[model samples]
Target: MTESLDDTALDRLFRTARTRNGWTDRPVAEALLRQVYDLAKMGPTSANVSPARFVFVASAAAKARLAPHLSNTNRPKALAAPVCAIVAFDLDFAQRIPELFPNNPGAQAWFADPKVAEVTAFRNGSLQGAYLMLAARALGLDCGPMSGFSQSGLDAEFFAGTSWRSNFLCSLGYGSDENLFPRNPRLAFEDACRVL
Candidate 1:
């Protein structure tokens, strides 16, 4: 088994990570975004459905298209971010089960129920979004994940005819520490966890 990560690495990935509201002028290269996804896609998922997909908006026109869907508070931050990622999931993700979980030919049947598929897509897709953030963070990029946006509007604007639906949005870049909202309190271990 691999050794556990050191505290510094842990801090960088979790403890010290903040939801940034502002970013630097430095551009985030498209290649870096590809690298981050390469890291994130390695993380596990149920049935290996791997439902998460992303659209990195760096172009002015794309960002402008996305702006109207964002809340007033998030609009400015989205505009300032070097790259804004639209994390989405395919509604028919289970169809890829045969390719992703090859050994189990019946894997697709397991999620055949529409309701079950819906839950799995949203749950696992959201997990993949978390993985995406960690990968970006590990690559020296700061992440600001926010949900203050119109999912319907975004879906219509970006995924109108596609099976993909927006799960969440994360802004990526070298963030300005000056832009942080004071770190909020988190539940203590005893309050948030349980050990049987």
Candidate 2:
């Protein structure tokens, strides 16, 4: 049986983790980015339809391309961070089911409908995005995840002619306390969950 994570690990991953609103000048390396993906990819998804695709905006030119797509409130956060990751979902994810779920040869047929494929891709991709954030935090990086951008604009700018569709953006780097707001309260377990 797997052992429970210690309190320190839990605190780092969830309890005390904050949504970074400001960033320092530290640069996130390519190797670290690869490591983050490697860990996040291990998270489970339905039928193993791993549809999430990440575009790391690390270079000045790429950040420039991303800036216009962000809202005014989010622009500075994205620009200030060392990397802004565009988390996307691939519409053609089902095509790879034969490779991803070899034991279930018929799994690919389940997503033949456009609607089913779209929903599965989006739902699983969002799960992967959350895994990505957790992995980043595990690697000692802070995250500022946002959905304030125009989806059509981001898709047009970053995913034209591709099956990938933008889901959200996450800025990654060392966080600064400059713009941090007081931590808000979460719903109690009884309020948000049930044993039945």
| Candidate 2 local lDDT, 48-105, one digit each (tens) | 9999999999999998888888999999888899999999999999889989999996
The best candidate by TM-score is: 2
lDDT for model 2: 0.94
Clashes by residue pair, model 2: none
Tens-place lDDT per residue, model 1, 1-196, is 5999999899999999888999998999989999999999998999788999899999999999999999998999998999999999998998888889999968899888888888898999999999999999999999989999999999999999998999999999999975687999999999999999
How high is each candidate's TM-score? 0.97, 0.98
**For model 2, what is the error of residue 117's alpha carbon versus the real structure, in angstroms, after optimal superposition?**
0.5
Give the residue spans of candidate 1 off by over 4 A: none
Q: C-alpha displacement of 58 in model 1, angstroms?
A: 1.0
When superposed on Cα atoms, how far off is each prediction in RMSD? 1.0, 0.8
Which stretches in model 2 have alpha-carbon errors above 4 Å?
Answer: none
